[model samples]
Target: MSSVAKVVRSARGLLLRGSFKQAATQLRADISTGPQQQHGTFYEFRTYDIKPDHLSAFLKLTDDNIQLRTAHSELVGYWTVEHGGLNQVFHIWKYDSYAQRTAVRAALAKDHDWMSKYISKMMPMLNSQDSEVNYLVPWCKLGKPPKQGVYELVSFQMKPGGPAVWGPAFQAAINTHDSPGYAQLIGVFHSEFGDLNKVNVVWWYESPDKRAEMRHRAHGDARVVAAVRESVTYLVSQNNKLLIPTAFSPLN
Candidate 1:
């Protein structure tokens, strides 16, 4: 196998042996290039571990209500994990500030439709213990603009041996491709353990078509193709929604 793939396989072995933090740190360091800071709004990354049966119902509700409309605020992006030794669902919501998030969530909680259709659907499979909610502070040191518009969130669960190969392939795709309706490429992040065993790559697109175009290009790229085949077992999931200023404090 290629050198990158070899690195990934080794990493995966380490992760399986319970060295999650070590594997993650190695991957982060391998792909450590670009400005240290970028322009972007703070985000709340919420993670959930749903029941296998309830997955479909929850996704349906999200697509119908949360992903499609902007009644409360922008959806920003969404993703779900299917394979790769890890099983979970994750989505990112944008807010103008912490306060706005509080208000919007409260409103959503009270929305009769959301209560009847959305919440009721996922009550069965929801894993209350493993779920998490956290704030993402973008690397503001870089001058890149904060991404706006519809976006897709891709979360990766890198095994101990996967990072060396996957990291470069991912970076190459993001840097070289011409994303059709893509607004910007947001920062990537490592997952917090209480959350799940994963890391994330956030992509910004103006429309679904644009997002598709970028993915097509990335998949077609020799580097990404090679990386996918050799380096890691990955999972991708997404949600399409608008982002708005948080209505209230998530902390409060």
Candidate 2:
């Protein structure tokens, strides 16, 4: 078993015995020994639902004008929904800190070209928009695939009370699939905005068919099945989206 699983199992036994103090101490020790979470970086995930008739135009406009806005910050990736949603575009932006994000937003508002050439034309093409700020889960870092391919964004709506309640099992499950090379784990993020206790897992595959094959193989692996079984006890609900990278996406 992985150290994470070991700690979680040991801690759970203490809790079952009503040894809350010992369980807390065990968790503290495990945390100290684990990889430190990167708290300095912030990622903004933005989703826009475009009018069906305007989707093509929106893509062209973004391809031509995204540089103006990206000048103020880093564009991690940009993708169009393929399976889970219709007429939706999703993108991620990286900022060194919250203050950096504030500065970027401020600069965008003042960029005349961005306002006139993009946002002005872009807003009317949308039916709705949403954004979430998130941090990379401690055990994960942004990763790249061997080459451009499709990406899957799995959103987990974990039960309440935050990571303190479900982080260990969640991490263990992720580590199981990731460490085994079952699929390319790109990133794992925990929401800091929108619904609380939300976790997003990004995976890359050569094709949808390959994703299916790997998933089947993974399910057959006892380790993965066991890890998933343990993790789901804390899950409330989950959904996923298959995304195709835009031409200018860094991940592509």
Candidate 3:
């Protein structure tokens, strides 16, 4: 709350506590330049492990409900795992803040039609689901690639000091990969709310063979080798997921 808001609240204590709190919140909202997105935008990343036979059906059901889910917040990107984890579905959502996320979730929960058309139908097809809250790294910006390209998501767990120990090395490696010819870097993000010290790098490729050739070339580059060697000292473990955009994905 602002200083003015505090003073007003003090003077208006005769009102109920709830009313006073609401007044202060309103005042803060009024004077804000914009939403909290300027501070650090948050992303909700989800992965659904589904039954092999349900993949096509699930994607279709989800595609049909895009409007319902997007009514709550921004859908950054969505894809189905292709190479690493079979029948896995992945999606990323952007929210201005935790309060906004909570509000959007609550609103969606109260919508009966949305629940019946989407939540109820999609839940049965998924074997399991996992979610993470992440923020884009300071040096990296979220990017957009044609939804038709292949995508690879690499999740990295770094040593416990967070980005301090591994950031520069990783950035150097990313720089090396973004050369004259290579897989396109989509975006880079690190954990913000859960499972600390984890980083996710997304890349876009034209084809599986192109990705393979790029990897072989990247491995041969002296700069990439040096960067990876330095970064690995602080890297605990890493996993990758290859994805293809489903129909109706905004990024596509």
lDDT of 3 at 242: 86
Predicted model with the maximum TM-score: 2
Clashes of each: 38, 0, 1
Task: Between candidates 2 and 3, name the one with more favorable TM-score.
Answer: 2
Give the per-residue lDDT of model 3 (tens digit) for 186-228. Answer: 7888887677889999998887788999999988888888878
lDDT: which candidate is best?
2
**Candidate 3: C-alpha lDDT:** 0.80
Order the numbered candidates by lDDT, best leading: 2, 3, 1
Span of 10 residues, lowest total lDDT, candidate 3: 29-38
- RMSD of every candidate to native, in Å, equals 11.0, 4.0, 12.6
Candidate 3 stretches greater than 4 Å from native: 1-38
Lowest lDDT 10-residue stretch of candidate 2: 30-39
TM per candidate: 0.43, 0.86, 0.82
Clashes of 1: 38
lDDT score of residue 217 within candidate 3: 91
